[model samples]
Target: MATKPKSPHQEQPKTAPPADEGRFRDDTDVAVDAIHQRIVGREQTEPEEGFEPPPVWVWAASVVLLFVMGFYLGRYSGSWSTVAHEVESPAAAAAGPVKRTVNGTVVFTGVCQTCHQADGNGVAGQYPPLAGSEWVTRDAATPIRIVLYGLEGPITVKQTAFNNKMTPFHDKLTDDEIAAVVTHIRSSWRNSASAVTAEEVADLRAKYGVRGSWSAAELSAERSAR
Candidate 1:
């Protein structure tokens, strides 16, 4: 005989309840609701403490601190002195009186200092020894041609050979400037030639207006021959 159909209760397999699923769902929903309430409450609350604004003095202090920092930074960066010097006018600047005699010395230092050192002893191979130079000792006119027309290529000074060239000063220097510089150079070294007068320089410049630098062949101990 067919066995009797199992009862629905017997047919259904016994299953254990899902552990913590319903409770977890309930707890999660509660926590979410609480968070939403907190958010809404925060939105409803008045803006907190009205941002206790800093005092006017504090703002002023901050501005002062920024200015001070910028000033010191500029000073340390070396831009301050440059900017300040640029901003100040030449007349307003702190300085001393410039000596007229120093002008000659300064010109010599700038132009002749390279060949003839500060002491006026020239380099052996590159430049002729200015000290005790016979050419410099000869006359004012000889040095004038040397300055105005310049010297070039294999010059013999006091039996010493100097092959280097000396640049012309006609265009670069004024007549007075040439006079002053030549006078200074001659007197400073072991040379004892008299000061080169501007009249002499002017005469030479007028005489040799467009001439190139003189070579040793072109130069002579006799100024009139040059």
Candidate 2:
């Protein structure tokens, strides 16, 4: 038997493709394989790189700041000496009593000047002159004892008589002040006299615990005997 050739107007038999077991398709017959493929229209962004170390300029600025701070400290730091010359001390230290080694010129003005007058010249016939007075310039004991205790009755200093009783200062002043006043008066006047030391005053005060006023007879009796 002979087979006849198909006509161009007749359609071929259509069969569905093999189905994807886990997927479904749309209402229109779109293939599941096409829907599962990578999308084509959207813009995809790549991830940025991980964290980086700080830039060079930041490190350089920190180094420059440290150098400036170090320079400033070295310039103004008292030549790096620990003397602390400007430290303020107590009022007693400034006054010269607590320091002990301090000079007596301040004590003379603060304590002795009232009675001895500012000029070392006492009132005529009332207080005796400290200037050129033999009692002060001759013997160390004369003025030291007199000032420590006081002087009573008539006393002749530089031939000027003072009958008024002078008050004692042992209770009023410290050993340092007494010594300073003695040193100041000795050097301050026109009279040439040796300086009295703080140690000397301490020794004398120890010998004479507490005593009453001194009489001219008592002071003059033992001149240069001390």
Candidate 3:
């Protein structure tokens, strides 16, 4: 019996198409559609080159306006440097003996005590003794002038030439406080002069018209003429 026809020994040739052919066509079509959409979107979003930027003059004017406004506002608000530098009031015009003995006392406590000593006998040669000094004991004008205007270059006190500078107390002290301090100083150190009044100081300031210190020569001339 012929064995059932011998099954074909050789393998049959593959009959099936590539498994991904339809999938590849579908993916390619989707990619093309996506590319078309992107091109359309970009065209809609981008502005044309013919659209010009704002004018240079407009920008420049805007900047200038801003700066001017800033300057004006700063000035009006008292924030400007020039306003700060301008003096509000003269320091010598405020506060005096009646209003501020404590402050006056404190000022002397720190500085005058050093040279004048606790008893007001100033250091010899290096510092002129304030005790019984003619300038200290003289009219209140002398000491007031000295305090308001600093002494400098060279000065003669008590028959000795004192070539040292004394810093002006005008800016550092109020008028009343200066008067108080001068009053305290004069009366304290072996001195018996009258109290320096703020009114007197105001008059002196008006008369001298000096914003700075006075030298002994200038003082002497004023004295001799008087």
The number of the candidate with the highest TM-score is 2
Once superposed on the true structure, which residue ranges of model 1 sit more than 4 Å away at CA?
Answer: 1-102, 221-226
lDDT of 3 by residue, 25-113 (tens): 47886676556555443123233233356799999999999999988898777554464455445564574333434455676788577
Please give the lDDT score at residue 197 for candidate 1. 78
- Give candidate 2's root-mean-square deviation (CA, Å): 24.0
TM-score of each: 0.53, 0.58, 0.51
- Give the Å error, residue 31, model 1: 99
**Model 1 residue 88 CA deviation in Å:** 22
Candidates 2 and 3 compared by TM-score, better number: 2
Candidate 2, lDDT over the whole model = 0.74
Q: Write the per-residue lDDT of candidate 1 for residues 1-226, one digit (tens) a residue.
A: 2354333222222233477665544788667665655554313323333334578999999999999998889877765355553344686555645435436788888898898788776887778877888877677788788888788788788788889878888888988788898888788756777887788999988987788888766666345564
Task: Name the lDDT value of residue 216 in candidate 1.
Answer: 64
Return the TM-score for candidate 3, rounded to 2 decimals.
0.51
Off-target runs (Cα >4 Å) in candidate 2 are 1-55, 63-100
The lDDT of each candidate is 0.74, 0.74, 0.71
Which pairs of residues collide in model 3? Answer: 95-176, 95-177, 96-176, 96-177
Pairs clashing in candidate 1?
none
lDDT of 3 at 26: 75
Compared with the true structure, the alpha-carbon lDDT of candidate 3 equals 0.71
